[model samples]
Structure formats: C-alpha cells, structure tokens
Target chain A: MIIEIVSWAAVGLILVTSTVMLIIHDWRINLGALALQYVAAFWLVTRHLPFVMGSTKLITGWMVVAALGMTRLSLSSEEDDTEPSSLLRGGWFRIILMCIVALVTAGVTTRIEAIIPGLGLPVIAGGILLIGAGVVHLGVTSEILRVIIGLLTLLTGFEILYAAVESSTLVAGLLSVISLGLGLAGSYLLLAGTSPPELENEL
Target chain B: MSAPILWIAIPFISGFIILSFLRERISPLIAGSVALILALTALIIPIDTALLLGSVSIKISPSIQFFGRSFTLTTADGTILALIYGLSAIWFFGTEASGTANRFVSLGLMIVALLTASIAVEPFLFAALLLEMAAMLVIPLLVPPYQKPGRGVVRFLIYQTLAMPFILFSGWMLAGVEASPGDINTTIQAGTMLGLGFAFLLGVFPLYNWIPMLTEESPPYVVGFLLWAFPTFTVIFGLGFLDRYTWLRTSPQLSGAIQIAGLFMVASGGIFAALQKHVGRMMGYAAIAETGLLMLAMGLQSSEMLNVTFLLIIPRGLELCVWALALSIIKPKVTSLKFNDVQGIARSYPFAVTAIILAHLSMTGFPLLAGFPPRLALWQEIAGQSLSISFWIFLGMLGLILAATRTLAVFVMANENKIWQRNESWTQLIMLGLGVIGLFTLGLFPQILQQFLVNLPALFNHLGQ
Candidate 1:
C-alpha cells in the first residue's frame, strides 16, 4: 500500500516537473526538470522491470541531459546570461496558453482510459502529460535545441508506457541507444552554426 | 554465409570503415564501388541455393539471428535488396558531383542498411525503432557545416519521432485485436491507431509541410536521397502490416479511408505545387503527390497493388536522382531557389536545365517517361474505383505539369541573345543522359520490369485471400 502511494506521488511529481519543463525558458532549470521527470518515470517503470534494469532509463536520460547541458555551455554567448521572462518571447501570455494546453491534456488523458484500459492510473496520466507537453513544446518552438528536448520528452513518455505493455531487453537497449544518439545529434545540430576550432585553425 | 549478413551488416560495417579511415579524395569512388559490388552480390547470391564454382560449393542462408532477433532475407528479397543497393550506388557515385561526398556516402550507406534491417527484422514492430534511428542519423547529414538546423529538419525529426509511439502502441493494441478478433471496438481502435501511425510515417496530407521546407533548406541532392529512401521502405513496411492482418486487408472502410487520404494528398500537393515560387519546394509537393499515388495503389487492395507500387518505386529513385543532381548543379549558380533567382540559367547550364525539365516532366507522368506507365495503371485502378478520385488525381498531375512548364520557362528565359552552353562535366552529362534514356526505355518497355514485380505480391500470402 505504501509502495503504491509512493509510486503515485512520484508520478504526480513527474507530471508537475514535466509541465514546468515545458513552461520554462531557462535551459538549466528545464534540464533539471527533465532529469527529475525521467527519474519519476523510472519509478513507474520499476513496476514492470527489475530495479537495476529500470534504472537504466534514468541513467541514460541523465547522460543525455548532461550532454545537452555541455553543448549549451559551449555554445552559450553573453546575451544568453540574462534570464528570459517566459518560455516564448511573448511572455506570460504563452504561459497561460500552455496552462490551458495542460488542462486539455488532462482532459484527453481522462478520456483515453476509455479506449486503452487496464493500465495504472498514474502511468497513463503521467505518460499522456509527458506526450502532451512534448507536443506543445514542438508546436511552440522551432529552435533546434528545444525541439530536441521536446522529442526526448516525447520518447521518454513512450518508453514509460511501453514498459507497461511489453518488456524486452533488446527494445530497452535499442531505446537507450536512440536516446543517446538523439543527444549527440542534437548537440551536433545545436553547434553546427559555429565552425569547429580545428576548421578555424586550418583556415 | 547469410543474406542479411551480406546485405545489411557488410554495408553498415563498410560505411563505418569509410567514415573512420577512407573519407578522403577517393571516398566517393570507394563507396560507389562497394555499394555496386554489394548490389551485384545481392542480385546473384540465391538464398539457400548452392553455387558450384570450380568444384567449390557455397550457399547463403536465408535467415540469421543476432542478439535474440531474427533477420530473414528470403529469395524474394534478393531483387528488392538489389534494387535498393543499386539505387543507393547511384546516389553515392553522384556524391562527388554533388560535392558532399564525405559524409553523404558514409551516412547514406548506414541509413540504407538500417532501413533494410527494419524490413527484414521479424516481429516487425522493431522496425519503428530502427526507422527512428535512421531518421536521427539523417540530421547531421542534412544540416551542413557552419549552418543552423532549419525548421524543416527539426520538424522532420519531431514528426518522425512522433510516429514511433503510435506504431508501438498500435502493435500492442493489434496483438489484443488478434487475440480477440471478434471485438469490434478493439478492431476499430487498433485500426485508428495504425492509420494515425502510418499517416505520420508517410507524411499524409496536412502533416507533410516539412517535406518542402527541408528541400528548400538542404542541398537538393541529400533531400532527394532522403525522399527516395525513407518513403520507399516505409511503404514496404506498411505493406507488411496489410499482409499480416486479414481484417485490415479486407475492410472496405479502411480502403476507402486510404483512397480519401491519398486523394487529399494528391489534390493538395498538386494545387500547392502549381502555385509554388520555388523549385525545391515544388519537388517536395511532387514527393507528397507520389506518396498519394502509392496510397492510391494500395487502396485498390488488389493483388496487383505490390506490382504497381514496385513499378512506381523503381522509377521514382531514378527520377528523384536526376532532378536532385540537376538542382545541385544549378544550386551553385543561384543565391536562392525561387523561380526568379533561376531566370536565364539555361544560357549557362543547358544540360542541367534539360535534365531538370526531363526529370520534372517524368515525375509529372508525361508520356514516354519512366513515371508514366505505372501512373497510367494507377489511374485505371483508381478510375475503376471512383471516377471522381481519378479526376482529382489527374488534376494533381496536371498541376505538376504546369509547374514543370513554368520552371522550364524560367530556365530558358536567358538564352534569346546568347548561344546555349553545356556547362556540366562529362560525368554529369553522361549520368543525366543515361538517366533520361533509362526513363524512356522503361516507359517504352515496362515489361522488362514485370518479371521482377510479379512475385512480390506473393510475399504477403495471407493478404487478398
């Protein structure tokens, strides 16, 4: 009974963190939220997988976040030091807009249980929120880095739900590989605008 | 020896090797030769048949197991693999001409291998993961050095990633549907999920806006390779779904949905292409229209669906290569790809202009070109189903033809006072000429392809029974 309560609590935290991640413009805080979101997802996935195995998702997700963070650090300029007011340049209006999106996502998840039943409430709700937030992120921004985050968030949601449906070692490993690859590719794309030091030296 | 090992792993390993040690002056030549040799080996090496060469016997197995998954490349796949690698060789060889040879050849080869593995993997739900991986690999290739990633590339990644969960979820639901075949609600839910999944995968209708944007931002050749490789394999993957599900194959509503979706893509792509100011964006619409044509063929749900689809496939690769190569040649001379930017280019680049026009005409299904015969067959099939659909499809083709004519006018606008010149290298001229001849030869005698396509439908033994 306590485990159930704890799991649901973790899920609730995940939902809040993912929503915040989607709502915020600060890269560091967003990455922090993303890492917490993955850790919370790890709690839910542990129901399906062994602790060590389920923990793989958290480890790999953090690794990805770290890779993204390093990329941001290397690529950040002086102007980026200022805290942006809102996620979108439009400010509070976009925040309210995303809040409405959150409400709609909650509504959609509540209804989705009718079609795809038998999953735990926390898993379903959390997964849907992650997916919904990810979509909103993608739809909201065209920035390559943010778009990559959105994709990663979306995949994390899918992975969490997929663990409940099927558990294959190969798939788990493949998904991990995909997450890592996304990180590297995202970093590459994020930095593609700048010439490498070697290239500059050669020139 | 295993066929999957030869077709999948060898190319992938070779790709890595080239990227590691051989990405030099001769990389394109090496990559092209390797792909060509692999294509030939795939063509000649029969699955499960022993070849006796001077008292030595060798046989390639049909299937291989790796890391608990099975990859089977049956004899039927020989031709498909041959076609894939052969077409891929065309792209790799042209890499030098396009001047993105280093990474394009390596990444292109790896992408092909992964896509092929996606098709071959048993318990095919795994293909979604492989496809997502391939899509990720495309990013570095598409985003050039010292340039920011464009909206098209980001959207492409998001949309492609978006497809995975739907497909994976559908696979889960489909298993339930299979277990309880009598459950109507379950069947409907599964079908909806599957439809949505494939819609995202195939970039159906409104979801396809990124296609043109990517074409506009990236080198036309790379975009062309992506257009050819991704959709062709994805269609094959969709066919696998249809083959496995009797209810899915036999459902009239599903077939109707496909036709409606297909018509929407064709009609919209055509109308938009007709109004497009940029030639690169026009190719994007053309791709969407071709996808619609494939969906139309599949909607026929007839035994000949595979045959018609394969026919479309072969020529599409050739035509896209020609068009992209032309665009890449013309690209260096333009500041932008808008029709206005390309005015009077024919005076400087006549061969490229000719290739671009010929390729566009072929794509528009002009007579005596490679895209015509299959398109004719497709029109007949759709007409048999609904004359309205046939009319809309024809309108779409007509729009493309108009766009092609407009582009041709722009290309030829500069040459009234000056004599025309062929600025293309010998390699470009030879390849373009060969592509043009291949297009006409295939159009005039499509029978040469019939034998290869005849047995493809049999791959789905459970479908159309």
Candidate 2:
C-alpha cells in the first residue's frame, strides 16, 4: 500500500515542480526538474513490470533517445546564449505556477482515480507531471526551436500517462512519428528565419 | 472502399507526376485539367448510388478493433469525397505559377487525399494523421518569400499539433472504456472523447484564430480552398464519428452542445469579420460563419438534415468558384490584400464587379441566389427547435447581408471607372458566362438543387446503437 502511495506521490511531486517551473517560464531549473520527473516516471513504470525484455527495451530505448535528444538540444543552445534568457527575471511567475500546479495536481489525482479503476492515483499524478514539464517549456520559451523541443518532451510525458492504460508500443510509436514531423517543421521554420549573409547590409 | 481511396489517390498520383516529371512547361495546365475532370466526375456521380464504388462495405465500424483502437470506413463517405474533389478542382484552376506550381499542387492533393483517408479510415487515428499532414503540408504554402511567417503560422501549427494528443488520447481512453469489464462508464468516456476530438479538430474556441492568420499569409485561392473545404471535411469526419460510434444524436446535451458551438461560431465570426480590413480575411470570417451554420444544421438531424447539408454544398461550390475567379483576376493588381487595396474595384470592371456582388451576396445566403434555399431550410429547421435560435439565425442572416453590403461598398469604392486595358478574350468571356450561368440557373430553378439536396440526408444512421 505504501509503495503505491509513494509511486503516486513521486508523480505528484514531478507535476507540482513542472507546473511551477512552466508558469514561471523558468527553463533552466524546469529542465532539471523535468528530466528528474521523467526519471521518476521511468522508475514507476519499470519497478513492477511483467518485466518483459521487450517492454524493458522499449522503455530504455525511449530514455536513451530522450537523453540524447536533450543533449543535442543543450549543445544547440550555444547559439541561443547570445540572446539573454527570457525568464531570468520571472520569479513571481514561478511562485504563481507553484500555486496553480498544487491545486491542479490535487484535483487531477482524485479525478484519475475515479475515472480509471485501480490505477487512478498513479495515472493522474503521472499525467500531471509529464504534461506539466512540457507546458513549462512551451509557455516560457521564446526561442522558437527550443519551444518545439519542449513540445516533444511534453508529448512524451503524456505518452507515459497513456501508456498506463494501453501498451506503450502503440502510444510511443505514433508519438515519435508526430514528434519528428514537428521537429522537422520547427527546424525548417527556424532555419528560414536565420539572418543570411546577404542581409548584412539590410540589418 | 477502393473507390474512396481513388477519390484521394487519383489526384495524388497526378500531383506526383506533375511535380516530378512535368515541371517544365505544361504541368500546371495538365494538373488543372485533371482536377477539372475529377471535379466533373464527382459532380456527375449519381446521387441514386451515393457511394461511387459498387459495394458499400464496412471493414471497420468502431465495434471491432486491433491493437487497442477502432476502425470505420464505408459507403457513407461519398459526400465528403465529393466535397474534397470540388474544392481541389477550384483551387487547381485558380492557381497560375510562372515557374513551378507543382509543389503547391502536390501538397494540395496530399492534403485532400489525407482528408479522404481521414473520412474513410476508422479508429479516428487516421483522421488525426491526416490532420497533422494537412497542417504540416501547409508550411510550404503558408511560409512564402516576403512574409517570413510571423507568429501567426507558428501559433497556427502549434495549436494544430496541440489538438493531436487530445484526439489520440481520447481515442485511447474511449477504447479503454470499451475494453473495461462490462461497465457503463464507457458511455461517458466516449462522450468526453467526442467533445474533445471535435473541439480540437474543428479549432473550436481559442485555437481558431489560425484560420484568419493563415489567410493573412497564404495565396488567396489556396487559402479559400482550405477555408471552405478542409473544415467541412473535418466536420464531416466529426459528424461521422458521432453517427457511427455512439448514440450522440439522441443525447440532447451532445446535440445541444453542437448547437451552442454553432451559435458561437456564427456570432463570433460575424463580429470578427466586421473588424477585418482584408477581403481575404473577410472570406475567412464568412467561412467560419458558414461552418457554424453547417454545424447548426447537423445539430437538427432532421431525417432531412443530410440532404440539406448536401444541398448546401452546391451553393458553396458555386460561391467559391465565383470568388476564386474574381480574386484570381484581382491578385496581380493589388500589392496588399487589404480592403483599402481593392476598395473600389467594382467600378473599374463592371462585369467583374457584378460577379463579385452576386458571389458575395450568395455567400451571405442572400435572396434570389443559389445560397438562399439552404439558409431558408436551415432557419426553418432551427425555428422548430426554439424561437430564440430562429431569431438568432435571422439576425445572423441580416448581419451576413450587411457584411455583403459592406463588401459591395468596398468594391464600388475600389472601382476606378477608368477603363482598364486588359484584353477581353474568348476564354475570359467563357469564364464570366459560366459564373453568371452558375449563379442564376439555380435561382431560376431552385428545384434543380432541391432534387439533389433531398437525397443527401439519412446517408448514415447511428450504426453502433
């Protein structure tokens, strides 16, 4: 019973952190918090699997891909550093985010339990965390490219919640395809906006 | 099933050929001709047998499933295909590219094909995919050279992508309920799914601004096609989901919700259009209003509603074609798409001005034109529900007419009255003649459309119940 409670609480913690991070538009801290949230979610899902090697592989594969994706994202941020971070002064936004997250997390937790039998508390708690992390990145970020990457993470979290009900294979597969499409489109939009050398005079 | 696939496939294959091999000289002509042929075929498709393909077989009807999802493709999809075929044809003819129009054509065909796929494919997942593809494909068209895609396209795409998870999760959730241990909770979950999916796909409240912004950036003809046809297809898909999946119509709340949405659309669209300075944007608003009207009609579900909606199609097509021609002629003259740009164009070309007036009036569902009968039927249907709704429709109609009057005023203002030097060629004469004939023919014989309109309702009854 306590194990279930803790699992649920972990989800609650992640969600609260994420919502707080997002509304405040605090990407740096939110990034750390979001990564940790996913880690906790990964632990929750895998801690008691029928433990199929394939499910294990799928979960691990997603984690590795996600890690690599974030790494590349961070590396790419080298250029963005040239522009000051938009959220450096947004402390009040963070506090307000915390209040909203706490209220929503509490509401969603009970609702999930009521909606889906046996798995409500965990599913609700986890869905909040995943969605919360993504929303932060989306709401706060000004860099168009970064926001796209943030969207992918947010969707990934939702996939986890959806996975609680259905198998991860179907949910994850469709999501990956959608993310790649989004990322490609975002990259195209971003590159299109880059200042060309010919425009040196124009600027 | 194959026939529905063909509705999407033929244009797709033609688009591929044009984009790849025929890029040099005649691709645009060839592409336009093919669209014309497809449109004609769709028009000629015998309403007696709604589905063009011989058998109206159903492979998936939301009852059966594989891998945690449902499927629903069948004969009832004919009207949607017809809608797509007509819209694409108009767009194809309406475009003229000096260098390469094939990419845009390819994208258009792909979008149409995906829309048909979304209609015919069951499980709603296919619909979401098509929606994604449709949104992504617009990137090429929306992000042109001069306007480097300001926040509008970004906002539009993000809103579109955001709708995806709601739809997918809803499908997943509904399936979960279906698989539950003999529970009544399934119904509520399914309802939530429908509400969320419909809201997401239709761009229901906050997310709908994309339509106008899209108009702000896109080629007018192409945007017009998207404005007119794509939402109609999505609405049809949404309506089909309601018809095939559950007892959505019987639920007064569900139908009432749709009516409420329709009311919001009609009301907001009118007020929003009034604020716009661009003619293209105005069309966007008008399309939104038309969408609301279609939704209102759908909500009524008279055994006659389907026919009424189908009847609504012909007038819409005619309105779009006339608008497309008028705009296509005007595109080169104006530097910007603002009303101030073409404020008095009506005085310059009397015939073009007349066509514009009639088309705008018809679009507003004005009297004595092709657009009136359906609006009349729609108002009559709404009146049976409640007088307040009837009053709303009446006011909406008046607002639409006033909007048309504004357009007329703008066109007249744009009219220079200084004889412009464009040649009056045989083809121009033919097009003008076609436009005039299309507008007045139905006005003279309303029965011509009423016959087609009568058979369209009752195409799909609630199958699952």
Candidate 3:
C-alpha cells in the first residue's frame, strides 16, 4: 500500500513537472524538468515494464537532452546578446493560461477513463495530460527548439501509456531509436537555423 | 533468396553506398541505372511461380522472416513494385538535370525501400514504425545543409508522427473488433480511428495545410517525389485495411464518410489551387486534389474501384515528375515562382514552359493527356451514385483548369523584344520532351496499362473480389 502511494506521488510529479516544463521557456530549466519528468515516468512504468526496459526510456530522455544541449553550445555564438533564459515574454499570463488548460485536460481525461476502461486511471490521466500539454505547447510556439521539446514531451507521454499496454522489446527499442533520432534531427535543425546564410553551402 | 530481402535490402544498401562513395560524381546516372535495373528485374521475375527460359527454372519465394515478422512479396506486388521503381528511376535520373542529384538520389532510394518495407511487413502494424523512421529520414532531405527547416517540414513531421499513434492504437482496436465482429462500439471506434489515421497519413483536406507550405519551401522536385511516394503507398496501406475487414468494407456509413471526406479534399484542394500565387503551391494543391480523387475512387462501391485507384497513380506520378522537373529547371532563373517573377519565362525556356503547361493540363484532365481516363471513370461512378456530388467534383476540376489557364497566360505574356531562346540544355530538353510524349502515349493508349491495372486487385484475397 505504501509503495502504491509513492508510485502515485511519482505520477503526480510527472504531471506537475511536465506542466512546469511547458510553462517555463528557459532551456536549462526545461531540460532539468524533462529529466525529472522522465524519472517520474520511469517510476510509473517500472510497475509494468521490466527495470532494464524502463531504464532505457530514462537513459534515452537524458541522451536527447544532452544532444540538444551540446548542439546549443556548439551553435550559440560567443557574442550572444539576449536576456538569459527565463520565463518567456508574457510571463505569468501564459502560466495562468497553461494552468487552465491543464485543469480542463485533467477533467477531460478523467472522464475519458469511462470509455477506455482496462487501462489504469492514473497512467491514462498522466499520459493524456502530457499529450495534451505537448500539443498545446506546439500550438503556441513556433521556435524550432521549443517545438522539438513539445514533440519529445508528447512522445514521452505516449511511451508511458503505450508501455503499460504493450511490452514488446522490439517496439520499446524502436521507440527509443525514434526518440534519439528526433533529438539529433532537432539539434541539426537548430544549428542550421543559426548558421550564417552565406556560408550555408559549405555546411 | 526471398523477394522481400532482394528488393528491400539491395536498394537500401545501394543507397547508403552511393551516399558514402559515389555522390560527388556520377551519382545520378548510377542511382538511376540501379533503380531501372531493379524495376526491370521485378518486372521479369515471376513471383511464386517458376519461370522457364531455355530449360532453367527460377522461382522467388514471397515471404522472408526477419526479426520474427514476415515480409511478403507476391506476384500481384510485381506490377506495383515496377510502377514505384520505374517512377523512382524517372525522379533519380532527372535529379542530375534538376541539380539536386547529391542527396536526393541517395535518400530517395532509401525512402523508397522503407516505403516498400511498409507494404511488405507482416503483422503490418510494424509498418507504422518503419513509416516513422522514413518520416525522420526525410527531414535532412527537406532541410538541407545550412537551410533552416520550414514550417511545412516541421508540420509535415509533426503530422506524420501524429499518424503513428492513431494507426498503432487502431491496429490494437481492430484486433479486438476482428475478434468480436458483433460489437458495434468497437467497430465504430476502430473505424473512426482508422479514418483519422489515414486522413493524416494521406494529408486529407484540413490536415493537408503543410503540402503547399512544403512545396514553397523545399526544392520542387524533392517535394514532388514525396507528394507522389507517401500518398501512393498510404492509399495501398489503407486498401489493405479495407481488404482485411469485411465489416469495414460493408459498412455503408463508413463508405459515406470516406466519400464525404474525399469530396471535401477535392473541393478544397481545387479551389485553393485556383487562388494560389505561387506555381509550387499550385502543385501542392494539385496533389491534394489528386489524393482526393484517389479517396473518392476508394470510396466507390463499384467493382472497378481498385482499377480506378491504380490507374490514377501512374498518370499522377508522371504529372508530378513533369511539373516538378519543369519547376526545378525554371527555378534557377527566378527568385520565386510567383506570377510577377516568372511572367513570360516561356521566351527563355520554351521546352520547360511547354512541359509545365502540358503537365498541368493533364492534371486538370484535358483531353489526350495521362490524367483523363481514370478521372472519366471516377466521374461516371460518382455521377451514377449522386449527381450533386459529381457536380461539385466537376467544380473542383474547373478550378484546376482555371489555374492552368492563368499559368499559361502568365507564361506566354513575354515582351516581344526578347528573342525566343532554348535555354534548357539538350539533356533537359530530351527529358522534358520524353515526359510530354509519355503522357500523351499513356493517355492515348491507356489500354497498354490495362493488364497490369486489372490484376492489382488479386493481391488482396477477398478485397472487392
């Protein structure tokens, strides 16, 4: 009973962290929150998937963060002149908006449990929240890096739910590969957007 | 060796090899020749039956087991493979002329291989994974070395990725529906999910906003190839679903839903094409319209549905290649493909101008062009069923016609002082000329392709049989 309660706490943390990551625009904070989100996801999924397989998800989530970070470092100019990463331009207004969306999504997902019955309620609710949040993130932002983050968040949510339902090794591996590929592609696009236009051909 | 391994592995391996070694020089010719050879081999090699050419017997088995799944290639697959590889050869060969030979051929070959794998993979839900991988692979091609990815590319990726979960989940639901045929709720859920999944994959109507964006941002030829390849295979994949489920096939409500969806795409695509300022965007709209036609063909309950669908595929492929090649050749001379930028370019590159006009006319179903026959058949089928739907579809065709006419007027409106000149190289002239001729030949003698088209339905055991 105690273990189950802790697991539910982890699930709740996943929703909180994912919402926070979406609400916060700072790359560092976003990355940190992503890592935490994965840990919580790993915790939830560990009940269903074997430990090794579950660890693959967490390891891959970090690897993606690492890939994106390295790309940002390599591509960011030394003479950069922008405010350091923080809450985006609209600030708390956006946060409030996100909170409303989260609340609405939570309500909708809670109701959805009636239709798709066999799946556990917490897993479905958390997964749907992540999916809904990721989509909302994509809808709001046009930045390549942010969109990638949104896509990854959405995919992570899907993996959490999908892992509960189907435990095929091949699928788990393939999904991990897809995650890695998306990160690498995201990094490439980020750098491409940053590169000098005249020197584009050389790249 | 099994046919699946032979077809799938060889092209993929060759693609990687070309990317690594031969891309800098002679890439187009090598890639083109390899595709042509592969297509020819697929054409000649009888799948599932031994062939006798001077006492030697040769038979290729259809299925190969890999990673505990099946990849099967049947005799019915031969004609389809031939069509895919043959059209690919056209794209590959034209890459040199279009000046996008470097990465286009290498990645193009790989994309083709992966799409073919999607068709062959058994327990076919795995196709969703392969398709996701293919969508990822397409990113580098869409966004070149230092070029930022466009809205189209990102949206395209998002939409394609979005399709995976819908399809995978539907497959799971479909298994339940198949197990319990009497369950109406499961059936409705499966059908809705399946429709949405395919709508995303095929870029139906509202979900197709990226097609025009992609055409504007990416190289016309590469975008054209994607427009052709992704939808053709997706349509087939959808048919496979219909083939598998009798409940789905017999559902009148489901069929009506498909028809309405198809009509919406046609009407929207055609009307949008008419209003587009950019030629590349026009091609995108044309693609959406053609996809709509294919959807309409699929929605038809007539016995000739598969034949009509396959018929549209060939001509549509040819039209896109012709249009894209012409655009690529014309692009270097202009900053953009807008009417003002390219007004009266016919004076400079008459052959390309002619090819573009012909291709667009064909797409609009002008007489004695490749897009005529299947369109006529589709119209007949729809007209018999519902005159109102047919009339709206006709309005869509009228929109395409208007766009083509406007394009021609713009092309021909050059200054009288500028001398008429053949700016295209002999190679481009030859390719454009041949494409034009092929369109006419196929249009005039469509019977030449009837044998292949008629036999395509045989691949699906009980589908529309």
How close is every model to the real structure, measured as TM-score? 0.95, 0.78, 0.95
> How accurate locally is residue B447 in candidate 1, as Cα lDDT from 0 to 100?
92
- For all candidates, the clash counts are 1, 16, 0
lDDT of 1 by residue, B1-465 (tens): 898888889889988998888845688788888889988887787777999999999999989987677888888788888889999998888877765648888888999999999988888888988999999999988887667778898888878888888888898888888889999988888899888888988899889989999999998999999999999999889889888877888889999999899999988988899999999999999989998988888888676777888889999999999899889988977999898899988888888888888888888899999999999988877777789999999999999999998998888888468887778888888777777888888888989887668667556667534
Candidate 2 global lDDT? 0.62
Candidate 1 residue spans exceeding 4 A from truth: A79-83, A87-118, A196-203
- Point out the worst 10-residue segment of candidate 2 chain A by lDDT: A48-57
**Candidate 3, residue A105: how far the Cα is off, in Å:** 5.8
Candidate 2: tens digits of C-alpha lDDT, residues B225-323: 666666777766666666654555566887788888888887777667766777777777777777778778777756666656666766776676666
Mind giving the per-residue lDDT tens digits that candidate 2 earns over A81-126? 5445545566567556656655686777777777666655665566
Error of 1 at B245 (Å): 0.5
